[model samples]
Target: MAARTVKRRHVSSRLSCKLFIVFTVSIFCVVVLVTAVRRNVPLDFLWGAFFQNGDVSNFSIYVHSTPGFVLDESTTRSHFFYGRQLTNSIQVLWGESSMIQAERLLLSAALEDPANQRFVLLSDSCVPLYNFSYVYNYIMVSPRSFVDSFLDAKEGRYNPRMSPKIPREKWRKGSQWVTLVRNHAEVIVDDEVIFSVFKRYCKRRPPIDIRKGKLNLKLQKQHNCIPDEHYVQTLLALHGLEGELERRTVTYTLWNQSATKTDNKGWHPITFSYANAGPRKIKEIKDISHVYYETEYRTEWCHSNSTSVPCFLFARKFSRGAAMRLLSDGVIDHFELSALLGNE
Candidate 1:
């Protein structure tokens, strides 16, 4: 009787130990599965949760066409005029909607064509420094992951003019002017959550009516939300696709010139001359080559010693009177025009 009792107790203890091990293994498996699913999910689904019914692949390139209270019909016409000249191999997304709306448009376009290779977003002032063939070949031959590096939060963060509702880990920064891959573009356009968060919290101040002496104190307090930096950065970071960007844009600009002028002022004519080089003049081919080689040319002039320099893919504010001079100066070739226009 004593031996039988001992064997029964041993069996019961062994059964209990087996059950405990099985429970622990099951919980671990569940945790790993959940993490994998979350990481694999598309950003569009997460952000565009509010609007679930749009085709995303119809368009390939996105152009952000907001002429914020400046420039004339000629400038606007120039963009379209030049844009239309490009071959139709690439689909161009153009609209004057708010940043959020523009993103939505991009999302709709992406859904319509998942296989689309490249997306270039441009402003009205932007011109194709190179011909369409060069641009097209650049898009087709470059690695699909070139745009990913720019989208990563680890790369850079946008200035939060207003507090964001989404967590900071999900934020990123890139140029308003960009060339993106189709998948990455879709992620940005389809993001519903990030856009809503920005729209609600990022307030854009209305233009203040300034009278001669009396300041309108009430207008000063109004929060104006400008979507240029924060809008694109936040959405890209959250999607984990930032690593795919090239960390550079192809547009060029001269920001230093634009800064000296007043806001809402008409475009000023900028001439690139050896005389105009200021204190830091590029005197020889070496100097010119050094500046061009060291600097990364995107939509703006960046990586220069002067803060007054304008950083853009295209510089505006040129006096209309100087337009003819600009066209004739042949300065465009100095801007690496040959490289961009290569074989196109």
Candidate 2:
């Protein structure tokens, strides 16, 4: 009887061990599946040298590429963007409320990591003029945030839609690309009242002729909501925030024209492609050194001033092809990005 009991006990123990192993493996697989996979690295060949010596602990990248962007490591250099992609990205529409939503989503995600001292938003087209460390240290030690918020006398800047909740005086315009400290970033994402008001009234009026697809004449007379530019600027202006707000941008953009599409007035930045990314056109991109500062004019919220730094850390509206052109045409070398990198 004792011998028989011992055999049964041993068999039971073996079965338990096997079940435990299976359970452990199942848990490991689940963790791997659920954990955020975004590595947030840059294109290896392009940015590999940037990160080669820089301490990884100093920065984190979170990208919100448009949905359905496929990744093929062979050509696309997609590995850098891997695991760095945000799953909560929204379809951003031009001059629509959804634009603000996307910005908030990015800010909210970055805020969770306390180590992120400063936040800057960049489109896929944006490329660094300086090395990663230079950009990092420059922002860390800076006294003010860089947002180009101004009041343009141009008709489309301020509308009556924002009245009691957001005074006309408080309404302001700035570049959509912005950088903020932790406090300001938190202030932007946390405010329900201000952003809610901007959402309700800060949208382009529907076209008067829907079937004809023509812009509304009356709508053209009033300001269209570019909330990404207005919301944070207005909030900071209203709260009497300063010093922390420099009202400028580190990202250089050619608001004059787009290479990919021809803006009728030459108001939008040109997108670069092989056809237009040549030296002559690229020279124009390199020459945008003009900077603006706060001014007293009723129409002009910010103006060209002597104090604005000529250092443009990044430039935008570059198509992926444009980025390659920059690399190919020795534009990156001209910017001295290689020489400036990792020096700190």
Candidate 3:
């Protein structure tokens, strides 16, 4: 009876050990499953979050008139006049819509002027640093206007987003603010294949899958999906406008180390000083001189220009104090605004 009891105890002990092993394995599996589910849950949540707010159906444009101020009345008048001129130009090219609607309007204008010689697009901030005759002469003498850089045909990789019918070589890229020749403008507005692709893919979110799982560094850089940078470059390169571009733009901008933001909010006003010449100020004058001398009144790649126009047609984020310095006849004279305006 004792031997039989010992045998029973041994069997029970073996069974308990096996049961414990099984329980441990089961617990391990559960933990792994839970971790995997938790990881996947965030991706789903992220997708849902982006999708719900990602529909851009209600996006609209807003246009605000510059507020009246007591600075130089002539400068103020020029600013307003330039604004109205831009508004009128858009009106002639396309019908009314919100500020967001301006892109489509521009497309319409492009379509109406396919041969690329009708209008020039300028921003309110751009002041002519050259006289009207110089500008007109430069445009007339140039082999191609600013639009050519944006809309010429050149060899490049094919964009799947664009229609297969349109070859991958006839694209162009440049600043949104440009002097458009009538024919090229028509081509842009009339380009059903390319424009459809652009409109579909050129919004806040690109339809391409290239950026998946990469921490969206591209989005952070430009702060939007299907940023204008990618849109113009890809489209123009695909459409064959690569070689026609003069590789220069007349605008100027300063994005150097000295322009770095001091605040956590990343806002820095433009500062002009007679005693302290910053990078932007120095670069602006240097670029102006280079263009005036080298290109004979033409500038190419004004803004860092690799992605878009290198510099801006006008620099913003200026303090009210800076504006006074900019408006002064002495400073303005030194910068040759008087020569550029000719009649102001």
Candidate 4:
């Protein structure tokens, strides 16, 4: 009787130890899969509903908002963003290498999650066009990262000085907003050679005033490089990972042609106003099935899981009023439901 009791005790102790080890490993994996972000952007009222019907447990949000900025009931509408900011957030500047630094910081924080399969980079102006489930499934179904890349169009944006670290042949340009798979995200986070070259060589040239002659003659010939625009696309190209990307951005932007024509500075995307944030405009963006790269002379027909699909999952530069207008109108939720039913 004494021997049998001792044997039972020994087996129970071993079973408990095995369970503890498995539990620890499972927690580690969950911590590894949470996603990351950096946002000064206010959450659109509708974005809350985007995840309402979905499995919120599957997605994690990590933010890299402006240093010292807090996301609480006073700052944002959603609890999801609360306490999401990175502790080591840095000040970001437009048209500078710091932009890419901020992106890298966000990516690094997100990569800690072993479960994170996709990493998305967004700007303050961006807004989700579909609900969370649709967007999540859309990205998860495809193996490719959505990286909008093409040949440089604006002359003198590439500095030959960057070669051979960033070869002239590998020099590419694209929108900064991108969705990367874990491997591509790792490549960006782990990159030292290409990012350092960009920090040293890729800089946005100041607007030259030839008439005023305020700029130096040498400066006029300097290449005007925007690091954020080129960094990810060029970095992926340098690593020979272009084939793993969808070669297009999931975020939509409307370049103001009229402003581009009138302003000599350069083109900037138009900010959608409440007046323009209607169901019709949302549908138009959703209807876009392809993107044409004039510089590369290549047309990208958007597809996911070998099924032809609309190009954009998100749209940007929406005013707070425009975002509220989208929510109150129920246009986004309606469209998302429609798409979901269509899929079924």
Candidate 1 lDDT, tens digit per residue, 1-344?
Answer: 00000000001121111100000000000000001111111111111111111122211222222222121232222121112111111222221115445444543433454344455544322332222323344444444422211222322123354344556455443345455555666677667776766666654544456662345566545543345445665566566555555544443333433433246332233444423432232112112211121121222222222222112222222332222232233322222323322343
With candidate 2 superimposed using the best TM-score fit, by how many Å does residue 67's alpha carbon deviate from the native?
A: 5.5
On TM-score, who's better, 1 or 3?
1
What is the alpha-carbon lDDT for the whole of candidate 1? 0.32
Candidate 2, residue 24: Cα displacement in angstroms equals: 38
Candidate 4 contains a number of clashing pairs equal to 8
In candidate 3, how many clashes are counted?
58
Candidate 4 stretches with Cα past 4 Å from truth are 1-41, 208-217, 259-262, 334-344
**Which candidate, 1 or 4, would have the higher lDDT against the true structure?**
4
Query: Each model's C-alpha lDDT?
Result: 0.32, 0.52, 0.30, 0.65
Q: lDDT: which is higher, 2 or 4?
A: 4
TM-score, candidate number 3: 0.43
Candidate 1 local Cα displacement, residue 280, angstroms: 16
Using TM-score, rank the candidates from best to worst: 4, 2, 1, 3
Evaluated against the true structure, the overall lDDT of model 4 is 0.65
**Clash pairs detected, candidate 4:** 32-113, 32-114, 32-115, 33-113, 33-114, 33-115, 33-116, 38-64
Residues 1-344 of candidate 2 have per-residue lDDT tens digits of: 00000000001121111100000000000000011123232223334333343455555556444553323452234243335545666566666777676666666767776656567766545665555545555666564566766654443546676678788777777676676766777887887888888788787645455555445555555654566667777888877775457666666665542333222232456665667767786555445444433232322122122243344566656665666566666654533434423243
| Model 4, span 29-65: residue lDDT tens | 0111112233323442455555455555456566555
